[model samples]
Target chain A: MVEGKKYRQFRVNKHLKRLMAKHYALGRYQRYWGRPLHRKLAWITSGAPVELLRAFKIYSVYPEQYGAICSTAKATEKLCQAAEAAGYSQDLCSYARSHIGSILRPDLAPMQGLPKPDLLVACNNICGTVLKWYEALAHLLKVPLLVLDTPYLPGELTEHAHQYVLEQLQNMVRQLENLTGRKLDMQDLKRQMARSAEMTKFWREIRELAQAHPSPLNGPDLFIQMAPIVAVRGSQEGIDYYRKLKAETEERVRRGEGAILEEKTRLVWDNIAIWPKLFNFTKMFTERGACFVTDTYSGGWAAELASGDPLESLAATYTNIFLNRSPEFRARQMIELVEAYEADGFVMHSNRSCKPYSLVQEVIRRRVMEKTGVPGLMVEADMADPRAYAEESVRTRVEAFLETLQAL
Target chain B: MEDFFVGVDIGSLTAKVVLVDAQGQALAWAVDRSGYSGRDVAQRLTQEILEEKGIKVEQIKVTVATGYGRVTYPAEREVSEITCQAKGIAHFFPGARTVIDIGGQDSKVIKVLPGGKVIDFAMNDKCAAGTGRFLEVMAGALEVSLEEVGALAVKAEEHKAISSFCTVFAESEVISHVSAGALKPDILAGVCDSVAARVSALVERVGLEPDVVFTGGVAKNAGVAKALSEQIGYPLLIPENPQITAALGAALLAWGMG
Candidate 1:
C-alpha cells in the first residue's frame, strides 16, 4: 500500500474547535440561562428554516449534527442498537436511529444526549424520514412539534410549490410565536438572513479556493469546517468562524499549499461522509495522492440565500435544497463541480443510511461521467453506521479507482 | 543469466504465481489453496515455480503482487486485481471491452479500453452471495464435488430458482429443495443462476460491452459462465487457466518495469 503523507491542518482549526465547543456548552446549560432570558431551546433539523427560529429568540440545536457527532465519537453502533431494541427497524436512517437511541440510552451518548428541547422542528426537504423521526420524538418527549412540508421539485421550483412552502413558513412562525410567547420580529429575521447569506458566501468562497492547482482543502476539511454552517447558520458566531476559515483557506491557496503533501489526482465527492471512518477512509485517498477538491454534501450549505422578502427567501431556500431536487439537477450540479474544480474523477458514497441521496447516485454518476468524460466510482457504506462498512472491500475499490486515474 | 519476471496473486481462497520470460511469454505457473496465510502460500508457490524453471531469485527482473493479499506480499510493486484483470484480459482478447471476475469473496465488472486501461468498474458490496465462496457453500449443501457441480448443472432438465440473495439463506433454500424431492442437478443449476443474477446486476451497473471476458477462479465453473452469459445476452470469453490471469497480468506488468 502506498502510504501518502499526512494532510496539512489549518491554524483556524483551533478556533473552530473553540467555537463549536462554546456552542455545545451553551446548549448543555440552556436550562439555566434559557428560562431566565426567555429563550426557548428547540431541536431542529439541519434543513429547517433556522433563521425563523432565531427571529423568535429560540435557541436551536441540531439532532442531525449530533448524530454525526455520535458517529465520530464511536457511539453510533451501540446507540443504533438501542433504538433497534426499542422496535425501531435497523433499516431506518442511522442518524435518526442513533439520535433516538441517545434519548433511550443517554449513558451511551456523547454528552448524555442533547439538552432537552422545549419544542421540535422538522423539514421534509432533506428526507421524508425526518417527518416520522420527529413525530416519534414529539411523542417521546411530549413536546410541541412544528413541521414545514417542502414539495419535491421534479423540474424547476414551480410557483405553487414556492407558495406552498411560504404558507408553511408563515404557519410555523405563528406556531413559534405561540410556543415562545413572543411576536414575529420581521427586522430580526432580516438581520438573521443577512448573517446567513454572508456566512454562506464565505463558505462558498472557501470551497472555490480549492479550484486552484493542488486544492487548499480535502474531503475531511470540507466536512469538518462545515460544522458552524450547519449548527449556527444565521448566527454572528457562525459568520465570524467562516471568515477565519475563508482567510486560512485563501492563505493556503496563496502559498500553493495543497491539503496533502502531493495531490496527483483531484476528485469531487458526492453524498454524506462516512463519519465512523472519516479520517481512515480519507487516508486511503490521501495516501494515494488523491484529494477530494470539493463535495456536494458540505456545499449544500454554500448556496446563497435567495433575495427579496426574508420569509419568501427562507421558504425558497429551505424548500429548494438540492436533496429535494430532481436527479437531472443533481447530475448537472456534479458535472459543474467536476468542470469547475477540474477534477480527474469523482467518487459517490452509496450511503446506506440516506435513501434520497444514495438512490439516484448511480444515475447521476453515469450522466456526470458521460458529460464530463471522467470516471466516477461508487462505494457502498453508511454515513454513520460502521456495521455497514467493509474495510477490505472498500480498500479494493478505492485502490482500483486510484489506479485507473493513474493509468489515465 | 536469463531475465525473468514473476507475478504473485494471494487471493482469499488460492495463491497463484505466474513466471514469464523477459519477452512476457508465459514460462511457468502454479496454484494452491491460500489456507490460513495467503502471503506465505504465495511465497511458497513463487519459490516452487522459480525452482521448477531453474531460475534464481536474482535472475527475476521484477515481481508484481496483486489480489487481496497483495499489500502484505514482498514485491517490487503491488497493483489492484481490477487493473491486473484488465491487463491480463486485454493480452488474450484485445477486442475485449468488459471483464467480469468472481473471486473467492468478491466479484467485479470492469470496463476497459483497447490497451487494457480501466475506464470504470463496479464490485459486489461486502456480500458472499455472488462469489466462489457462495458456490462452495452451496456445493457443500448438495453433497456435490466442486469440480462436478458445473457438469451436473449442465445436464439438469429443469433448474430450480433460488430466491434468496444471502449465502446462508440460499443454502437453506437448497436444503429445502432437497426435502421437496428436487434433483441435485436442478438445485445446483439454481445455485449457478443465483450467482449469475447477482453478478448480472453488477455488470449492468458498469454497462456490459461486446467481447466480454470472464476471469477469476469462479470462471472455471462452466455452469456460472453459461448462466451469466445467458443473463447478460453476451457470450463470455474464458481463458484456459482462468485463475492465473491476474497473476499473469501481474507478471506482464513486471515485464513492463524492465
Candidate 2:
C-alpha cells in the first residue's frame, strides 16, 4: 500500500490494487489475447472519449496516468532527464516529458514503460500539449494517430462549438471503423455510455460524502482513488471498484472518521497531485490536523456526462471540460466547492506543468477569496517532475496558510 | 524574577533573536550572520541576550522560532515567517493592512487583519529575482558593500534600467552598465528599481492597502524603499529595526502563549 504514516488506509484499497493490477497485467500481455480478438491497444489522453474507444473494442492505455505512476514510483526524474537529453525542452509538461522519456529509455522507466501502442488518440480538451505529445508518440512508435479537436470555451458551450466536436466524433468513428474493420455499434456505444455514467455518479457521490463534518477523504486519497476513473472508465471493473470505494467511504462518514487522525482545518485543493511528493507533501498538513476535503483535479472526473444522445453527449462532455472553460467559470466552481465542502481555505498547486490550470489560478483564487471570504494559497511545483519542487518554500507557505486558517 | 520570552528568526542570510518580558515589551535583541548553522547562531544570540539582561535560562518561559531555520531550532513552537511578520507589524502598526517583506532568499506580500491575522499572501515562486539576494548579487557585481548599496543608489541623478528578471542576468546587466562607464550610483539605483519592480508585482497579487508596512532586511535600503513607495503610490511604514520584526512577532506570540 502507498499509504503513509498517520493516514487512514481504506480497505477498498486492496480491491483497487487487484483491479488496477489486473488491468495493467492485461495490457502488459495484450499481444497474446489482443491479436486473436483483433483488438488494438491505443495510447489515449486522460480527457479522450474512452467510452467510444471501449465501444470499438480498442484497448486504451493512458500515458498521462503512467506518468503519475512513474512519479509515485520515483522514476520520473530519470525518465524526464532522458527526455530532456533527447532535445525535449525542460519547460514542456513534465508528464509529456516523462512519458516521452519512457519511450526513449524503457530500461529506466517503471513497468519497462507502458506497452507499445497500435495507435495514438488525443483530445484537446485538457490542453494543446497532448496533441503534440501524441504526435511525438506516433512518430516514435509508427502508429496511426487520431485527434479530437475540442474548441476552447471562453463562455458557455456554443451550439457551433458543440457541432464542431460532434463532427469530429463522427469522423473519429469512421476512422475507428476503418482501423478496426468493424461497424459502428450504436447499442454497444449506449451500453458503454451507461456504464460510464454510472461509474461517474458513484465517484461523484463518494467525493460528496466528504462534506461530512470530519472529511472521510484527504488529498492523497482523492488522487490515488482517481486511478480507475481515469484509466478504466466505462468498464465493469471500474464500476465495481468505485461501488466498493463508495460504500467504504460512506462507512467512514457514518462513523465520523476523518482520513487524518484529527481533522481541524478542512481545505480544498486545486490542480494535479504532486505525485512524487504526494504522501510526503500531504504529511505536512495531516500532522497539523489539516485535511483536504475536496479538490478540483480528481473532481474533474466526478462531473456527470452531458445530457444528450450518445454522440452529442460525448462531444459536449469532452468539449466542456473545466480546464477548457474561462477563469470566471472556474472561479465560480471553486467558490461552490468551498461552500459545499465547508472548506476553511483553498490551496492551489500552481502546477508548472499545467499552463491552462495554473496560469489563471491567481485570478480564480482572488475571486474565490473575495466571494467566499476565505484565503487561498498558491504553491508552485510540477505535478510529475520533482526538480521544480522547493521543499522548504512549500513548507513555509503551507504552514503560514494553515496558521492563518487556525487564527481565523 | 519576571517571566521572559524569546523569539528566534533564523533566516537564510541572518539569524536574529529578540527577548521580550511578561507584558510583551522588547528587552533586548541581537542579529548576526546565520553562517553555517542558523540554529546555532540563534542559540548563541539567545544565550548572549539573556546573559546580558541578567536573566537565567530557567526564567525564559517560552521560546518561539520563525523563518527558514525555524523547524530545526529547538523551540516551544515554530511559526512561519509570514504569520510572524504580520503579528509583528500589527503590534507596531495596528492599522497596517498590507506587508511587503523581502528577506534573504524569498519575498512576500501579506494582507493582514487589524490584529495581524493573514487574510491572504503572495510570495515569489522559486526565484531569487525579487529578493535581497538579488540586491546582494548586483552589489557584488558593482563592488559595493551591502550596507552602502542604498546610500549610493539614492545619489544617482537618473537610474539605469536593469531589464532582466533573472538574478544572474541582472548581474550581467549591472556589469554591462559598469563596463559602459555608467556611474556606480546610477547602476545601483537601477538595481534597487529592479528589486522594487519585482516586489511590486507580488504586492499587486495580494493587493496594496493603506498603511503598507515594509519589513525584512531589504526594508533598510533607502533606494529600494523610495522606488517601491513611488511605484506602489503609497508611503511605506518601516520599523526602526526592520529585520527583527518577524523575530519580534515570534517573541510576541511566545508571550501570548503564556
Say which docking band candidate 2 falls in. Answer: high
Q: Which pairs clash in model 1?
A: A4-A287
TM-score of each: 0.98, 0.98
lDDT of all predictions: 0.93, 0.94
Docking class of 1: high
* Candidate 2 Cα misplacement greater than 4 A, ranges: A1-4
What's model 1's TM-score? 0.98
lDDT of 1 by residue, A41-123 (tens): 99999999999999998889999999999999999999999999999999999999999999999999999999999999999
TM-score of chain A of each: 0.98, 0.98
lDDT of 1 at A240: 87
What C-alpha lDDT, on a 0 to 100 scale, does residue B99 get in candidate 1?
95
